[model samples]
Structure formats: structure tokens, C-alpha cells
Target chain A: MQTVIDAHNISKVYNPDTIPVHAVNSVHLHLNRGEFTALVGPSGSGKTTLLNIIGGLDAPTEGQVVINGINISELKPNQLINFRLHNIGFVFQAFNLIPVLTASENVEFIMLLQKRPKAERTRRVHELLASVGLSDKLNVRPSQLSGGQQQRVAVARALASRPQFILADEPTANLDSHSAATLLDIMEKMNREEAITFLFSTHDQRVIDRARRVITLVDGRIENDSAATQIRH
Target chain B: MLLKLAWRNIWRNRNRSLITMSAIASAVLLAVATVSLQQGVWEHLIKNLVSLYTGYAQVHAKGYWDEQTLENSFEIDKTVEQQVAGTPGVNAIAHRLESFALASSGDKTRGCLVVGINPAEEENLTRLSAKIQSGSMLESGQDGALVAEGLAEKLNLALGDTLVLLTQGYYGSTAAMKTPIRGLLHFGSPELNNQIAYIPIQLAQYWLDAPDRATSLVVGLEQAEDLPAVARSLKKSLPKTYEALTWKEMMPEINQHIEADSAGMYIMLGVLYMLISFGIFSTLLMMLAERQREFGMLNALGMQPWSIARVVLAETVFLTLCGSLAGLLLSYPLVWYLAENPIQLGGDMAEIYEKFGFEAIFPATVKAKIFVEQTLVVLSVGLVLAVYPVWRVLRLNAVEAMRN
Candidate 1:
């Protein structure tokens, strides 16, 4: 399997010289193509921090985070932004849909920034929103949509750029059982049908149960990996 | 899409947006109105002053401005007339022969400026015929003299009264004459009114024994703005013996006076603009605070800081444009109304204006530059205030910004 991400000895130290707090200490990890993996840990266990570094939203104090054979730590700010636009997608726990944009416009924003053709953007927006069961809510603003529906629109937005992988930080933490289950079903179907990789950080047991592989962290270090689901699907 | 998002975002907090827009609009409207009135008053004062005696420009013997005497008067030859006439902006030229003379009627004797003019040309240039307070305008080839109202009052002379004028003429010649007061001309300026007397040019030449000679040619232009250009052209074409001077050169005191007065107005405008900038900045700061998480999400989603800044700037520009355009549209009718029917001054202000020989009224000018300049100034304030929010976005830390 092609390696999508290769992070080696990544350490993030806050206030290194005085009362240093090791947020993520010398953590090594790899995520291969076509894999649905979860980074599970308790609150403040550096799962979100590691995900942030892997997604290039942050920089580590030591070592490098390599995504698709390019060391993102070495890239300039502008280059990293361009790389992320082309290759990475993000889903915040809050379903951070732009309040002003309609559901479809939220999804279309990434492609717009990517400078995609207008026809292709329109086609993909329709297909993606329809696939996420938000076709009826395409013209609705985030304030007018339910939490579950808004999250689904966020998912569609993450997929609009056709990135190498999607980083979902606590994707189902805020949802109830039914909505979480429904969101999982859509994400599972997309992963299985389109072979799009998904990396999520969650403490939810339900989210852990569905992931093919899970890496559990404690005290900013990985404590367990489910050996039975080590192979990429 | 960027513009659409910006537009929608502003309307999301409609009340806040409206407040900001109102602030900008009010500032622009007030600024436009204030400048319009200032320019109107200044133009009116300048027109009154220029037409009082000196036209928009004057052509005199090179040394005549320094020494007002019959020896410095130049002959109105064909070359000089043609050169002055060929100048593009020169609408009309009124020739004058000016000298100091003592007038006595019965008991009172006063020194006054005696000006000889071609009645028809003078009337065309300065509208001298319209200034007649009592009696009739001076006719061409009339042997009568027109005394200014103040001068006539001082000399205690009425219409058709014999006023004696005694003065030295060309080449040390003693000039003495008696003529009837043909008209009493009203002068806005007390000094000019107290010291001016007009007689026909031919009669003046005959009395002074200076044939075909005039002290200066007062040149009027179609528009006041053309005064400088016409003066420059005339100066270039005129002989070294002649000097063409615009009203600005002829009246440095007025320029200095305007400059001194404008310093205070500019300070007031500066304070107004500062308040306007603060109003806009407060709105931006509030909006930014409200949308911290949204900006963070955008930042995390691979949207460049520059892109986010562009969106914020777009919002600012939209608001600024809306406010400025509305203000500009609203100002036209308001200015027009004020200009058509000026605000009359009363009380002490009216007394002061009258003392300066000006009408006591506030009028607004309906000029394109007032609108364009005020719009630019207000828009620039918006753009300048936008920098604070743009800087906030440029340095945004997504993790921290998203925390709340």
C-alpha cells in the first residue's frame, strides 16, 4: 500500500525552556492509502495535536511530518497552504460550516479556492450533496440546518476537493447515537466505494468499534494498536 | 463567490452593518456639505472682490503697480489690443486711467481715486451699470462723473451736483475740472466706496492731456478658473514694459486670509475623519470577534491568510461603497436646495459679514469635485480601518482561534 502519511519522532513541546509540557513526545506513525484509522486517546492525550501536525495545521518542535512523500514541516507557510488545499480535507467536531453560505455553497467553497472549472464545481456540488443526503437542504444556511445535517454538509465539503485523505477530529463526538450511526454509515460507504482514506481522532467507543484499525494514545504516546486490523482494507 | 460571501456576511449582523454604514454615510454627507458651503462662500466673496474694481486679471505698465501715476500709463495701441484680444480666455477688457484727485463740494474736501473708463466695455466687464444706487449709469462720451456712494456722502454731493476735481495730470500738468455727478454707484467695500470716482475715458484723457493712454486693462474671463492661464498667456505675449497679474497676485492678503482660515477647517476635517475611522474600526473589531471561529475554520481548511484578508477587505469595500454612494446621492438635492435658497445669516454674524463687504448667507456649491473628493476620503477611511482586521486574520492561529 502507498504511504499517505509518514510521521517520525514528532514532538511538540509548549514553553520548552520553562515548565515544559510535552504535548506530543517523539511519536511515530504511518497512515497508508485507502485506510480508515482512528487516533483514540483520553482528553489531553495529544491525539488532536498529533492530527493537527499531520494535517499541517501545526508544526512540531522536533522531527518531521511527511504527507504524500513531502515533508510538510520543511514547507513554507504559503507552500503548506497550497499543499493542504490540494491534498487535505478537514472536519471539525463542531461541524464548522460557514454561517453565511448555503449548504451547497459551503461544499463548493473548497473547489472555488482550488480554481476548478465552474461546470465541474456545479456537477460535483450536486453529486456530493446528494450523496450526503443534503440535496433538499442545498440552499439552506448552517443556522437553518440540524447539527447532523450540517456535519454531513461538512463531510461533503471535505470530499469536494478529492483530497488524498480526510482528517476528521472527533467526527461523531457531538452527535447522538442515531445521527452518529447514520454519519458512520455514509462515511463507511464513501470509504468503501471510492477508496478515499479517512483519519479520525475520537474517544468514542462506537467510533473505535467501526474503525478497521485504531491507535490508542495515553500521556502523549501511543499505548496500543489493534493488531488484528493492522492491514489496510 | 468571495463577494457573495462578504455580502451575505455583512447582512448576517444586519443591525451592526447598518450602524457602521450610517456612521460612514453621515460623515460623508456632513463633509460634502461643509466643503460645498465653504467653497461657495469663498467663490462668492472672490467674485464680489474681483468685480469690485480689479477684474480676474489686470495688464498694467511694468512699474504701474508699484507707482500709481499718470507717467506710468501706457498707450492703448493696436498691437496691445490685438495681443490681449487674441488670448483665448479673455472675455472682455475694460481700460482705466487711475489717478489720485481731491474732490470738494461746498465745505467737504476728500482725496479719492479717479478712474477713467470706457463706459460700455466697463459695463460689460464688471456689470458697473447694475451697481447704480441713485441717478443713471455713465454714458459713453458723457462729460459727467460717477461718484461712489461713500465718496458722494463724504463730499455731501447729490445727483446733478457740481463736484470739483483737482489733481496733477501727465508731465507735471495741473488738472482742474468741474463736472456733474451723473450717478451714485454702490460699493460693497467701504474703502473702495470712500475713494473711487469714475469718469469717461475720452473726457479723462482730455482733462489729463494724456491722449490714447490708459493706466491698466482689466481682463475678465468666462470662468474664474481660467484667470491664471489667461494671465500667463498675456504675460508671455506682452512686451517687457507690461505686466499681466491675476487676482491672486493682485491680492495676496486674500490668499493669506483663506489659508489662515482653512487651517482650522482642515483640523476639524481631520478630527471628523478620525472619528469616522474609529467608527468603522469598532464595527470591524466587533465583527472579527464574533467570527473568530469561522475565520479559524477557514484558516484550517487551507484558505490562505491573504485570501481571508481579501474577503474581509471586500466586505469593508462593499460597506464603504454603499455608504459613500448613498451619501453622495443624498447630498445632491440637499446641496442644490441650499444653493438655490441660501441660508441667511442674522445677528452678529450678519453684522460681521456686512462689515467685510460680503452678503451674510451660507450657500452650498453643487460641484463634481466635492462629491468625488468626499467619497474618496470616506472610502479611504474605510480601507485604512480595514487594515486592523486584515492584520488580525493574517496572523490568526487556527487552533487558538477555534477553541471558543
Candidate 2:
């Protein structure tokens, strides 16, 4: 299987007066293409830190993270931004969409940044919004949307650019079980049907059960890597 | 889209936006009023002063005004009248004969300066003919004369009373003429206003035994704005024996008063700009600080630093444009109305202005430079202040911003 994300012995440290606090100590991670993976852990397990590092959002004290054969850590600051723009998408725990942009425009932001033709951006934005079942709410700002709807909009925005890999950090933590299950199903369908990789950092058992493969972490190290049972309809 | 977003964002916090906008509007209004009032008052003072003293601009016989004497008097034929009146910005030009003379009413004699003005064109230039308080102007080619109130009182001369005016004419000639004081004229100032008499140009010329001759041309301008330009142009085209001087050049004291007044106004305007700058800068800084998290969310959503900076600049530019334009629109009509009917100061205020030699009522006038300069200064201040907020946002770390 082609590797969508590969990190080797990644470590993150916070130094206070030259004394290091190891946030992620000697962490190694990998997510294959078309995989629906969960990084399950307790509080302070550094799962989110590892995900952030692999998503090209944060630099590690020591490591090499290659996403789709490109050495992300070796990229310059502006190149990393461009790399992230075309390759990796992130759905943060807070569903951080710009409050001023409409649900559709939020999804179209990356397209706008890429300077895509207006017609194509419009078409792709509408398609993504419809995929997330937000077609009727394109003009509504994020503040007016519900928590689940906002998260779905974030998912649509993450998938808007047709990125190969997507990372979700505690996406279902703030959602009700019904919305969480529906969101997991939507992500799973996109992952399997489109061969896109999905990575999540969470403690939600429902999210873990829905993910096809689970990577469990404890104390910044993977304790178990196993396949999840198929979700009962 | 960025502009639309910026516009929506500005109105998002209506109170803050309104506060900032109101501050800008009021500042602009105050600036307009200040400029118009100063310009209007100064122009009125100049015009009134010209009517009172030098008649806008004066044309003298070669060196007669530079060195006043009977010897310097030159012939005032139709040629001089045509030349003086043909000069650009010379709305009305007239000849005058100013000479030292003695006035006596039965042994009550006084030394006086007598000015002989052309009665035909003097009405437009000096308007002194209408100010004859006792009787009338020189009537219908009559050699009848007008005397200053103080000159009449000192000479004990009443209307229709006769007095002897004696002077040395051309070539050390002894000249004397007995003429009736047809009118008594009141003047504005205590200083030279009541020490002179006005007679018809021909009458004074004949009396001084220099027939068909006069001293200078008293010219009025069509527009004071063109005074300096007209003076320079006229100076270039002048006959070597003559000089063209605007009212400002003619009277050093009045020019000093205008410069001193403008200097004070400039200081006040500088202070006003500083005050407005502080108010606007603090408001923008506060808005920036309070919206750090909001901006962070925007950055996290992948808005480029340039995009963020652009949005802020657009908002500020829009705000200033709307505010300044509104201020200008409102001030135009206000100044127009004020110019038509000037404000009147009462009681002590009136007395103070009179003591200071300014009119009690202040007038307002529109000046084109006021609009252009006010815009440049205000926008420069705004553009300078915009740098702080943009730099602050650029220095922000996304993680720290989100954490905050």
C-alpha cells in the first residue's frame, strides 16, 4: 500500500530554562492510502501532537515526515504552506471556520488561494457543500450553523481541494452521538469510496469503532495497532 | 469578496464602528469650519482694507508715490487712463492728485493732505462719494469740494462754506484757489482718515496749476486670488517708469496682520490633527487587540497575511473616505450659508474685535485647496496609523493566537 503519511521517531519538546518537557517522545507513525485510522489515547498521551506533526502544521525536534513521497519537514516555510494547500487537510477540534465566510466560501477558500478560475471554484465549492448536505445553507455564516453542521462544513472544507490525506483532531468530541455517528459514516464513505486517507486523534469510542484501523497510544508511544470491526448498521 | 467581507466586518460591531466614524466625521467638520472661517475673515478684512486705504492697487506717476511732491506730478491724459484700465485684474482704475496744502477758515488754519480723485470712477473704487455725511460730492463738473470731518471741524467750515486751499504747484509756482466745502466726509480710522480732502480730479488739477495732470491711478482688482499672479504679470509688462503692487505689497502692516493671523490658525490646525490622530490610533489599536482571536481563526482557516492586511486597509480607507466626504458635503452648504449671512458677535466680543481692528462678524468662504489638503493630511495620518494594526497581526503566532 502506498503510504499517505510516514513519520520516523518524531519527538516534540518544550524547553523551560533548558529543561525539556517531552510532549511526544520518540513517536513513529504511518497512515496508508485509503485507510480510516484512529489515534486513540488518554489525556496528555500526545496523540494530537503527533497528528499535528504529520499534518505538516508543526515541526518536530527530530524527525522526518514524508506525506505522499514529499519530505514535509524539509520544505521551506512558504513551500510547506503550498504543500499543505494542495496535499493535506485538517479538521481541528474546534471546527475553526472563518466566522465571516459563508459555509460554501469557507470550503472555497483554498480554491480561491490557488487562484482557480471563478467558475471552477464555484462549481467545486457547491459540490463539496452538497456532499456535506449543506447545499441549502451556502450563504449562512458559521456562527448561525449548529455544532454538527459546522463540523460537517469543516469536513467539506477539508475535502474541497481533493487532498490525498486528511487529519481530524477530536472532531467528534464536541458533537452528540447521533451527529458523531453520521459524521464518522460520511468520513468513512469518503475514505473508502475515494481512496483518501483519514487520520483522527480522539478518545471517543464511537469514532474508534467506526474507523477501520485503530492505532492506540499511551505515554506518547503506540500501545496497540489493530483493525476495527465493521460498524453495525 | 475581500472588500465585501471587510465591509460586513466593520458593521459587525456597530457601536465601535459608529464611534470611530463619528470621531472622524466631527474632526473633518471641525477642520472645514476652521479653514473656511479663517479664509473668509481674512478675505473680508483685505477687501475692506483695500476699500479704505489703497483702493486695491495704486498706479502713480513714475516716482510720485515713492516720493510724494508737486514736482513729480505728470499729465493724466486719456493715454494713462487707457493703460491703467487695460491692466488685467484692474476692475476699475482712477486718477488721483495727492499734495500737501494749507486750509484756512478766517485765521483758523491747519496743514492738510488733499487727495483729488476722479469722480467718474471713484464711486466703484473708493465708494467715498456715498459717505459724504454733510452735503454732496463734486457736482456736475463743478469745482465744489469735499472735506474730512476733522478737517472741517478744525477749519470751522460748514456745508456751503468757503475755504482757501494754498499749495506750491509745478516749478515752485504759488497756487491758491477759493473753493466751497460742498460736503463733509466721515472716515473709518482715527489716523489719516480725517486729515485729508477729496476734490474732483480736474478741479484739483486746475487748482494746483497743473492742468490735465494728476499723480496716480487707484486700481481695484477683479479677484483677490489672482492678485499675486496679476501683480507679477503686470510687473513684467509695466512701463519702466511704473510699478504694479498688490494691496499686500502696498501696506506692510496689513500684510503682517494677515500672516500673524494665519500662523496662529496653522498652529491650531496642527494641534487639531494631533488630537484626531490620537483618537483614531487608539480606536484602531483597541479594535485590533480585541479581535486577536478572530484574526487567529482567520489565519488558521488559511488566510494569507497579505489578505489580512488588505482587509484592514480596505476598512480604514473606506471609513476615512466615507467620513471625510460626508464632512465635506455638510460643510459646503454650511459655509455657503455662513458666507451669505456672517455670524455676528455681540457686546464685549464686538468691542474686542473693534479694538483689534477686525470685524465683529466672521464670514466663511470656500477654498479649493482646503478640500485637497485636508484629504491628504487626514489620509496620511490614517495610512500611518494603519501600519500598527497590520504589523501586530503579522507578528502573531497562529497557535498563540488560537490559545488566547
Candidate 3:
């Protein structure tokens, strides 16, 4: 029942060439503390735009975004960076892992950004990689790992900071179906067990089926919000 | 952790790092070495000039220094020597007599400056004894005179040859003294080489009709910088009638010459710094551009804009310190090896240097100040040049950077 992310009539207009384009229009959503929500829309339907605003990566033209009792619109750049470092973790469609870092190093990176102690970061990295089934690939770079393994590392990284909210923008878009399903299972398990909120922007049925609550987006507006009671347990 | 990340990141593009370092090192090498050599040559030239002409400083009757004439002259005695030697920082003091005299040898006569000095004390102040190539310096007060080498050659004289000296001595007194040419000595400057002559202080006093009197006391010191301080102390310590002057104050023409030379060097150093600064700034600019995506992600990952600037500055500081020290170190042996065996300037340069009376060999001697000054200049300029990229990185938009 706890609202982790609350939006009020948020709209984003971008000026690409001195002419305004409505990227997202009059959108509203609320994510509970333990919710796994899916935002289903076609390409360019402003799914990423809404996700970016909620993640505090962007500012909308005419609305306020509130997360964890603080309105992000009120924060300056440095405060915003502090908020992101302490309270948010992100996993992107292409993995977005720094290619130069190894598997565990990529996961340990968030802990580093937090300026956590080295020994604690190492231990946490070990535990997270193990949890993601990548204990053996800890020292392997992204090029040396499979798609599913790299995505798992990203997932571990997203969970590294132990944030109340996680944002995944088409995380499984580049994975094989088997890898996709496997990753979805890991995300769902983390969502339910740890009470970590997750919001994914996906058109894939696999990702949609794995969500407890699904919101269908069309042309930058949410058309429907539905909940399914298909707990596979 | 910051240092660790910075170090590791530098090694990622080894070629780029090497190029940047090499640019810095070569810059330091050229600038520092050039400065060290120029300073060395300047010291050598001043040493020779001071030894040959006015000693390091002089003490004369008040108003006599500003206007050199017979009217302002004073007598020399044990009291003057005792007073000058009693002053602090006065290494040596010798009595001297100077007059404009006409010298005639078989009707070929020229106007010349005739100097009278105590042979023993003058030896401590100037290299007058060693400059005597043809005959002995006046060892005994009874006999012999030291004439200019060029003048002696023009007069067709050798050791023990006598020349007639005619002059209006002190108080409009007409006097003449038959003197034997004891030796011939060369001066550092061409004009002095042509027309100056030296004699025993008593003998010159006798010829000038002011027997036991001198025009001034030539004083010498251990170092050039000590000259002004000693001059000040002498001014306060000595009688009110006498004044003290350093070589720089006494010789305004030479001071102006050196000042003009150094001003030109300043303009040249500005050019060199611009070249090096551009080299460093260009390399850093390219590096920032190449690593745009990485910097964007670092910002996204919670590294603040200030932290990014610190990282870049750290890179430049490290590079500047290492390169400057390495260049200075390597240049030591290079310059020492070169100074010990100088490079000869052949053809036109050889002819030119010889014509100007400078040595044909270009030798470089290192000074501790040259190293410190050149290093400070390069580091400060490089840091200033670093401002461009640091500002660019701080103002860079994160999303646009990620797309870069």
C-alpha cells in the first residue's frame, strides 16, 4: 500500500528543432513498494520518456514527480545525484554495463559510487553475483560472457544498492527467449521476496506475463491498468 | 580509490598517455636547457668583464663618480685604505689614479686613459697580473709600467722599452715621467684593449703632480649580488665625502644592454610557452572528446561534475610534475656533457662570435634557479591551459554526452 513513485499529470515536451514535440502527455501512475509493474507500449509511445522522468533522469514540462516522500522537482543537480546514488538502481535494454569492467566489478560499481568500504563492496559483489548464478563469471568481462549472464550481472548491479525502487527499460529486449524468461524469473523473485518495486517498459509477452500489474500505454497515455492473480506458486 | 581509478584509466590508452608525456617532456627539455645555457654564458661574460675593468665596485669623492674630473679628486693614504677595508663585505680595497693623457711614440700620438694602481692590492681585485703577457707586472715600485697590449703593439714596443707620457696633472700642473714598459695586458672590451694603461699608484701620482694622492679606491667583493649590499654598508660606514657604487650602478650602459637582452628573452619564452600549452591543451581536448561517453556514464553513476574536473586536473598535474622532473634530470647530464666539451660554432657563427669577442664554443652550465623557474612556468601554464577542458567537462550535458 506504500506508494514508492507518485506522478501527477506529468507531461514532457521536447524541442528537437525549435518546434515542440509532445513526448509524453498527461500521464499518471503510482507504484507500490512491493509492486512489479509493466508499461506496455509500441516504440516511440513515450514509455522511455515516462520511465526517465520517474527515475529522475529528466524533468517534465508541467508536472511534479514525487519519490520516497521527496519531490524530485525541488532537488538541485548535486542533491539529485545524491538521491540517485543512494536511492535508485537502473538496468537498461542493452545492459548498459561499462564494457571495461569485469562482471563482478560492474556489479560492485554501484557500491563504489556509494563510497562504501572496499571489503564490504567485495563481499556484497560476491553475494550478488552468486545470487544471479554468475559466481564463476565474476572476473569475466562483458564480451566474454553470454547475453543472459551479462543481463544477470546488470540485475545484480540494480539490486546492489538495495533501493526501494528499480527501473528496467526493456531489459530483456536483447536477450534470447530462454534468457529472457530466466531473467524475468530472477526479477520477479527479487520483487516478491525483497519487497523491491520494479517498473519495466516492455512489449514482450514474456515480460508482460511476469508482471503482477500491467498498464497498457498508447500514444503517450495509459489506456488501461489491469492486475492478474496468476501467482505461479 | 580515486587515484586507483585514475591510474588504471590512464593505462587504458597507453599510446595516448605516451604521446602526451612525450610532448610535455620535450617542451621542458627545450625551454629549461635553453635558459640554463643562456644564463651560464651571461655569467661567464660578466665575470670576465668585471675582472678586467672597474673591479666589482668603486669608492670615489662625493660628486666625483657622477662627474669624473680632476676638480673632484681626493688624496690617497693609509687612512682611506683602512676605512675601506674596515667596512663589512669589502673583500679588497686598492688605491687607483686615473687621468686622460696623450701618449706619443715617434710622433704617432693618441689620447688614452692612464690608470695608477697598487700592484699587490689590484691583483686581489682584478686579473691584471695574469693579463700581462709580454712582461712582468710591476712587482717592485721602482721600475716598469703596464701598457695596453694593443697600444704597445701600435707603439712597436717590447718589454723594457721606454715611452714618453705627457699630461696636465692635478692643479693644472705640467708634468712628464719617462717610464719603462714592464708588461702588456689585454682588457676584456675592445675599446679598453686599445687605449688603457696601468702604472704603480705612486708613479702615476708623481706624474700627475699630486704625489701621495689618488682619484678613488677600487673595491671588490666575492659575489655580484653582494655588491649593492656592500655598497650600502660602505655608504653608511664611510666618511660623508666619499660615495660607494656597484658595477651595475656605475656602468649604466652595460646595465641597459643586459636589460634589453633579457626583455627579448622574455618575448621568446612567451612563444615557447604558447607552443607547449597548445600541445598539452590539444592532447587533453582530444582525450576529453574521446572519452565523452565514459564521462557521461560516470556522471550518471553519481560522480559529480566537480569530481570529473578533479580527475582531469589530477591527470595534468601528475603529467606536468613527472615530465618536468624527468626533463630537468635528463638535461643535467646532457648539459654537463656538453659544457665540458662545448659545441663549436663553425663558419659564419664562429666568425661572428669571435668578432664580438665571445668564445666560439657554446657551453651550457646548469643553475638551480633555471630548473625551478622553467618547471614552475611550464606547470603553471599547463594548469591554466587545463581550464578549457575542465570547463567543457563540467558543463557537458549528461544525455548528450552519453550519446556522444
Task: Tell me how each candidate scores on DockQ against the true complex.
Answer: 0.73, 0.35, 0.42
What does fnat come to for each candidate?
Answer: 0.66, 0.12, 0.29
lDDT of each: 0.89, 0.79, 0.80
Best by DockQ: 1
Question: Taking the tens digit of each residue's C-alpha lDDT, what string does model 1 give over B98-130?
Answer: 889999999899999899999999998999888
Better of 2 and 3 by lDDT: 3
Query: A1-233 in candidate 3: lDDT tens per residue?
Result: 88889998999899956998888889988888999989887888889889888877788898999998899989998888778777777887777776667888888888887888999999999999988888999889888988888899999998888876889989999999999988998888888788889999987788888788988778888887887334222
| Arranged by lDDT, best first | 1, 3, 2
Candidate 3: which stretches are off by over 4 Å? A16-18, A93-113, A125-160, A172-193, A202-209, A227-233, B76-90, B102-111, B130-137, B140-142, B181-192, B227-240, B343-361
For model 1, name the residue pairs that clash: none
Summarize candidate 2's per-residue lDDT along A141-187 as a digit string, tens digits.
99999999999999998887778788899999999988888788888
lDDT at residue B390 of model 3 (Cα atoms): 90
lDDT of 2 at B126: 72
Candidate 1 positional error at A205, Å: 2.3
Best first by TM-score, ranked: 1, 3, 2
